[model samples]
Target chain A: MNKYIQDTHAHVLIWLEEAANMIRESFTEQLIIETKSNFSDLVTNMDKSVQNFFIQKIMEYYPTHQILGEESAEQFKDTNREHVWVIDPIDGTANFVKQQDHFCILISYYENDIGKLGYIYDVMNKNLYYAIENAGVFLNNSKLPTPPAISLQEGLVSIDVRNWYGKASLERLATEAFDIRYFGCGGIDSIHVITGKFAAFAASIAGPWDIAAQRIFAKELGLCVSKFDGSDVNYLKGGNWVISNKAAYEDLLTIVKEF
Target chain B: MNKYIQDTHAHVLIWLEEAANMIRESFTEQLIIETKSNFSDLVTNMDKSVQNFFIQKIMEYYPTHQILGEESAEQFKDTNREHVWVIDPIDGTANFVKQQDHFCILISYYENDIGKLGYIYDVMNKNLYYAIENAGVFLNNSKLPTPPAISLQEGLVSIDVRNWYGKASLERLATEAFDIRYFGCGGIDSIHVITGKFAAFAASIAGPWDIAAQRIFAKELGLCVSKFDGSDVNYLKGGNWVISNKAAYEDLLTIVKEF
Candidate 1:
């Protein structure tokens, strides 16, 4: 890896640790929460604060880098920027507000629209899963081997079963797969796929910040990340996507794509 | 608690710790698995061994107690027995074989067909949630307070989304509730209800041993346990049951009873 990317990774590790502590501290006090988009979609004061922390650090150290974040006010439209950072301060805000677990912080770095470094920090579990471009994926600094291929019938799958046009697809997947589970968090579900515990994770709708980090990890870990129709998932534009093991991707997509 | 019950609970606690250690040790060796009713209904060798261990202990100590177990060869039919025990060595056998995290051990003691004591041991997480008749529920020896009432729209509910006659009912619950989650384990889901982490847990199908322990926990915690049609759940004939908060019970049953 390049020196600049290596140094940025070091900074991110330190920042995530500090941010985790902030989240832990917030648990002791009452949280200020508001709904977004719908009743189930939630955002807490901590989400905004954490996003601002990342934006400030990125701007201070890499002044020229563009930023796109879940809680950012201004839209980041300059696609031609050489360096861009994407962040979801809290990937599972509802889980964070309700369970105080099964949530994570997501951050990714892109150079010329190409993925570089991606991080998914499960704050409560204290597990940091990150991937480097052309290098490898690591969980808590331990290199992870490519997970063994598993079929939908041989392994479990986590899915989002909300009302959607693809309800039939999800039902079919649920019936055909060994079983279905949902932690109500995309990042945690994706981690199950990364660790070979789940065959796949499919969601009907998501934002760029939600699926960004998993894309990098999927590439490095030899997993498949694509839209429900088996199209290449654009990191900048996430709609509906599935991250899955190679053995189960085709079968899972067959059902998931029936929308 | 009666003197006999208290003495019995003490012995059960010690036996559970030993069983947990045995399970942890079994993880190091390869598991021998077999299917029961279907491909998804699994029984590992450990399940049988654990059930046998409990059977041996009960016969040696009580000598006259009627025993019903998941892996037992002969059916236990003497319902008039003054003392009876129901045991599911591993509540989530599929999870035990797959994830090894969400599964647990379920045991219940009944006197004259009334629940006297129940134990649900999450062997991996090491959380032992148990309830005693006329007393209170406890988690790892710490007494647990009654969970606050929460409506269907106010709290999450876990469901078994497998193919069944009540598929539409489940879909309705998933839509009307705040959200849905599943650990694919009934005991773990019941534990969530006991701790107020979830408003309810409903399974479309289950066996006697599956729902016995939860009945005891529900009574002590002031939660509602019933059939899908708002009828009393039979501890011996576990078909379809829901253990839910009083606030959510009616609304959940209104949807779940459509079958």
Candidate 2:
């Protein structure tokens, strides 16, 4: 890692800890909530508060770095900045508002459209999963090993079974695979894949911040990350994606692609 | 609680701790796994060992009490016994073999078909959730309050999305409710319902041991527990059942019963 990236990683680690403290403190207060696209798509005051915390920290420490976050994405118009940090202050807002446990924060650092560092912090569980480009992936500061290759029939698969298309795909995957699991949070579900707890996690839709961290983890851990049709995932614009073990990627795609 | 049950509950608690230690110690050794019913229906040596441990304890402590456990139900033929203990030593066997977490122990005490005391011990997390016949439920020695009433659209719902029927039911619940979640364990999923983390948990098929402990919890917490068609859940038969909150029970059953 370069000196600049290494220094920035240190700052991010401290910021995430402070952000997690802010979230934990807010649990005692009444959350001011609003709906985004739908009722289930929730945004609480804590989400905006956490994003603002990152934006302020980034603007002060590294003025050159452009920030794109879930709550304050429109403030930054330049998409092709040399140094960029894509973040979802609270990835699973619904879970954060409802369960307050399974949600996490997703952050990805890119230098000139190339991934540099990524972090997925599960705040409640105190699990910080991060990957430094070309170096290695770490979970709680320990090196994470490449998960074993597992077939669809031998491992569990998670999916977003919301609409009819998702329902149809779930039907096929449920019977073909060992079983199904859904944590309702993309970051948490992806953690299961990287840790070998789940064979794969397939989602019908995702935003850039929703999948950016997993992309770096996939590269470091020898896992596959791609769109539903097995195409390269665009770092800037996230669509339907799957983070899977190579052994089960083809079988998973065949069923997920049916819809 | 009578003297007989009170004395038995104390002895059972001791046995559960010893059994948990046995399970934790076995993690170091290679597991002996076998499939039952299907490839996904897994049974590990730990399951048999744990169940056998409970059977021996109950037979020695309360020699007259009957036992019905997942691994050794055939050994006890009389189903109409006055005092019976239903046990699932390792509830989520697949999870035990794969993740080594999320699986739990379920124990229910019944007197002539009447639910008395129930226990759902999450061994890894060390959360022992239990309920007395006329008393309230407790979590880890703390009294657990009755969860709030939440509507279908206001809370998360878990389902077993396996066959086509479950798929169709999931489609309805996914859209109608807040969203879907599945931990792939019946005991774990039912705990979510009783804790208000989820509004309901619907399953198309479950064994007697699967729903026994949950039945006692439902009676104590005021949550609804019934078959898919709003009928009484057979404690012994254990067919399609739903453990739901009263606020969302009707709406949830409307979708779940269609299949």
Candidate 2 on B122-196: residue-level lDDT in tens? 888888999999988999879999999989999998887665334456667777999988888899999999898
Please give, for residues B1-259, the per-residue lDDT of candidate 1 as tens digits.
8899999999999889988889989999999999998878899999998998899889989988899898883668774659989999999988888887889999999998899999999999899989999999998999999998888987888888655323677567767998888889999988888888788998989898989889999988889999989898888878999999999999998988985
lDDT of 2 at B58: 88
Clashes of each: 0, 0
Q: Model 2 - which docking category?
A: medium
Clashing residue pairs in candidate 1 (N, C-alpha, C atoms within 3 angstroms): none
What is the clash count of model 1? 0
Model 2 DockQ vs. reference: 0.64
Instruction: Give the clashing residue pairs of candidate 2, or none.
Output: none
Measured over the true interface residues after superposition, the C-alpha RMSD of each candidate is: 2.9, 2.1
